[model samples]
Target: MTELTGYQHGLVLGKFYPPHAGHHHLVRTAKERCARLTVLVCAASVESVPLADRVRWMREVHPDVTVVGAVDDVPMDLGDPDIWDAHMAVFRSAVPERVDAVFSSEAYGAELGRRFGAASECVDPGRTAYPVSATAVRKDPVGCWEFLSPPVRAALTRRVVVVGAESTGTTTLARALAEHYRRRGGIWASTGCVPEYGREFSEEKLAELRRARPWAHWSEVTFGTDDFPLIAQRQNELEERAARLGSPVLFCDTDSFATTVWHERYLGGRNPRVEEIADRVDHQLWLLTDHTGVPFEDDGLRDGEELRPWMTDRFRAELTRTGRRFLTMSGPPATRLAAAVEAVDDLLGRGWDFAPPLPERR
Candidate 1:
């Protein structure tokens, strides 16, 4: 997360049960002024199906936005005033606190920003483009959800998420492949994988020690799992999105599978989640990279490479235990990315229509 300044940040809110053109222009304009934009989707429920639907719909339209949970720290009750205030607080807390400005359509948002000491404005979609909204869409579900913003419609088609461990080129390959998919033009985004929690240990002495065995806490629910919750949560969210739109949705940088791998290797066995995911997944492409050539570099959370071998082995073993075959790219970074692009092409060719997504910001 970076500091927000110079009036470039804005908050776009909506259920997005079905995205449309007006939503597109507003997001597009906001991105132009802000280095980053955050979208706050109003979910109708927390049940897996509804949540998944929203996430999937959003993924289709705003492919690059860092989609996150809004109800996590607050109640999802739309009618509860205390809960409503709490909801705003939760989003405000999770949101990049330092934003230059806020974007909204609701009347209260302007006043809300003023009370909070943020510069805010309501961008009038009615004046700029087709202003059809959820109300009209609800009145006609088939017609409305069908006609969505180019970005939104494109975002909804199908998703591609790349998964791997730290130092592996998941992020790099994700972006490259995303762009490669975009050239074919439908909707695609290289969603970056989640950050590792191990790096968060701030105890200088304990951190330096690297935790003897590191397996003790692997099964502790309180302690982060050998199979991290982020992966499960990520899957849970994506599944909800797919179920919501009644369409196939994809997410990259999964946690549970990656977690299952680590836990199995640590415990010298398999985690059931890994087994379920192998056949459960529509497709899985694992990138095997030897961190030997790459020097240990801590990008904020990734602290050291002493454990790189341990992490790599767990990922590999998990792939094997599940009988999941992966693509191994052992060489320079560029070579790996090239191979990944080709492999993805082969996979998508199996059934993907392969439409180039909307044009990304230059």
Candidate 2:
């Protein structure tokens, strides 16, 4: 209340489901009042924000304050009296040292303080000082962008992936759109592409295998069947890293779904790992390149010219079966680029500049 001072060690506990400005205010208030401040980020398995990501945000925002990431599997129904002990156990594990004060804007602060033998203080208990909450942020993260950190915004930013069969200009179209967004100038003025990590991996493996065993064909070896999962894994990792770089939008050359399509066609079945990663990588839009009359240029790695149409059919069938949103682009590079640009622009136009209305109280 009155400047919140005179405490040696202060503690603050929160879900930080997706940290908003109000949480920032509470932590900063505690940090100013105490000699040492500990902000525990307690996350459940079902929470939208992962425990590691929340810890990263807290540490980045308040580098001086000690931040603890606690994982609690116990159910989170406040009405259930059984949850308190589970919560207390998690708190004790994180904040082991004796605390002098506990600061929070919720009534639970008093009870939490009692468990630590610390005095309790409420800061902005009525939510008048800062009008944001984690619930409001989660319901409409892009709309509540102003209150979120860069890492959180990066996580929320939608990635549009351009994918298709081999020799269908996936890289060309992806790079073109990325450059177009870069030149358009806005929050998306510096867009980046998650280049096909699979292609890179394939080229490397091709050279390595050829050098090691001249008689061995890549198609006959484990490289054909076993390498896709690793490629998909690396591709996902690169996409996440690109997102963390803070570009408002990412134009991915290809996605793990495309890799699964290739796996189904080449390896005779599906790689379960690739399928699992495909489910997790959320591409806002899929721009499937049409194989209509686009002459297949022999790029050292492609022996699938005859299989081009078949692969295209495979991609179309899978997209339809999975119920994914996609637009097929055919014609010359210019025509395809124009169509892709229009679709992406429509997505941007619809999603841009949204300010979520204040959430209704439960």
Number of the top TM-score candidate: 2
For model 1, residues 1-362, the per-residue Cα lDDT tens digits are 23453454556655555556666666666665566677766554432225455656566667766455454424344345676576567667657456555676655566557645677767783544565775564444334544554334334333444555566666666556545554553323322233333223223224444466443321232323434344454564554344344222233444346656555434556556545553444444556665657666555344435777777776676568767657666677788778777776665455433222222122
- The true-structure Cα RMSD of candidate 2 reads 6.4
- Model 2 lDDT tens row, 1-362: 23456788899998888887889999998888998899998877755567898899889889999999988776554455557777788889888888989999987788778878889989998778777787676565545666777677667777888988779999999999999888866555657888999888877777788888876555643456668888888888888888766456788998888889878877789888889988887778899898887888877777778888888888888888999889998999999999999998887656533233222232
Off by over 4 Å in 1: 1-161, 187-222, 238-251, 262-281, 352-362
How much is 261 displaced in model 1, in angstroms? 2.8
Q: lDDT (CA) for every model shown?
A: 0.52, 0.80
Off by over 4 Å in 2: 1-6, 13-17, 20-29, 32-36, 40-147, 210-224, 350-362
RMSD (Cα, Å) of model 1: 15.6
